[model samples]
Target: MNTDRLIAVLAADAAPVGPHVVEWRIASALSIAACGAVALLLLSYGVRADLAALVATPIFWAKLAFALTMAGAALVATARLSRPGVAVGRVWAALVVPAAIALPVALVVLWLAPRDARAALLLGNTWRTCSLNIALLSVPGLIAILAVVRSLAPTRLHLAGAMAGLFAGAIGTAAYCLRCPETSVPFWATWYLLGIAIPTLVGALVAKKALRW
Candidate 1:
């Protein structure tokens, strides 16, 4: 290679990546994973048998993965929005992609699961229980996260929001487990899926609006 070209290539390769982006990504991933794991653990181990199945099944795992991924994307978008030159529309568009992918996947997975499995999945009673639980768990955390973001301008608001939702879902699941009589895997699976989905949807909506600069 020519000397000038070699120097230019080295400079490009040695360029410093932004620390904020790295911190944002790591924080987002860890926050979501930790919150989701803690919630699921509590529901599965601390709560009754009815709650034990909350984390069971491919569908639940898939949704968790999807929700966390979206949450990460939302955080990235939020960080971008905080920058002076970035466009809000672009950030919003990027944040929406995960939901677009997850909604269809959720539909198909739920539709394809065996009838008994579908039954186990909570649509009516479990759905209602989980929704209430999610709301209770999420509300306070959401307030705290929004406050922190407002004051400190952390780039991980989306991650914080996701953790809040996951914690809420877990606590909510624990509450529902105490009240629920159903112990079957299918019931827990169904209801748990709903629980995760509801918060994920709500988080996405919040991110769309709140993450805007």
Candidate 2:
């Protein structure tokens, strides 16, 4: 067969892509996963009893801000990775900014506190279970987002998987804030980071196989 003839034949039946298809699909998948995470939180842990009081506090908002900002950043990175040749560039800064801000604030708070009281700030009441719970909440999002990525054309499989996992973990962390009574910045800087890391590491480890084309 003539090469030009074959190329023309292949192009003849190609369909034009609809606008915002990738964005719509990924957003829809993550929305469903967020709902799942919320439901899991309600069923398993319930909201913090003093939520009404906590709602008026600045620290509560700060915790939510950090988690959600990280989520938004991870979503952008994962979306870029989903395509074949898109440049990721500085999208990672979004992921770092929240943590970067939180860490310095945490250190400052720790430095100002009495030495004996430092442990209480770093290890909140639920430290043992917090990371595990956040990782558990991430499962639904991980499965959902990974499925979305698998259907797309991600070339950088490991990075894509890690970003997806981070997105899931960040959203899960935000949901967890409702049930978590820890009011200390140091605690969030430590345990919440561990929670997010759990899934991110998992994604990197599994990506080569899970994201295989």
Top candidate on lDDT is 2
Write down the RMSD of all candidates, one decimal each. Answer: 10.6, 1.4
Residue 213 lDDT in candidate 1: 41
Candidate 1's displacement at residue 86, Å, is 3.5
Task: For candidate 1, report its TM-score.
Answer: 0.45
Clashing pairs in 2: none
lDDT of 1 by residue, 1-27 (tens): 999999898898686667675446445
**For model 2, what is the C-alpha lDDT against the true structure?**
0.91
- Tens-digit lDDT track for model 2 on 84-180? 9998889877789998999999999999999999999999798999999999999899989888887787999999999889999998999999999
Can you tell me which runs of candidate 1 are displaced by over 4 Å? 1-56, 83-85, 88-91, 105-124, 152-213
Which pairs of residues clash in candidate 1, taking residues 3 or more apart in a chain or in different chains? 120-186, 120-187, 121-190, 122-190, 122-191
Ten-residue region with minimum lDDT total, candidate 1:
145-154
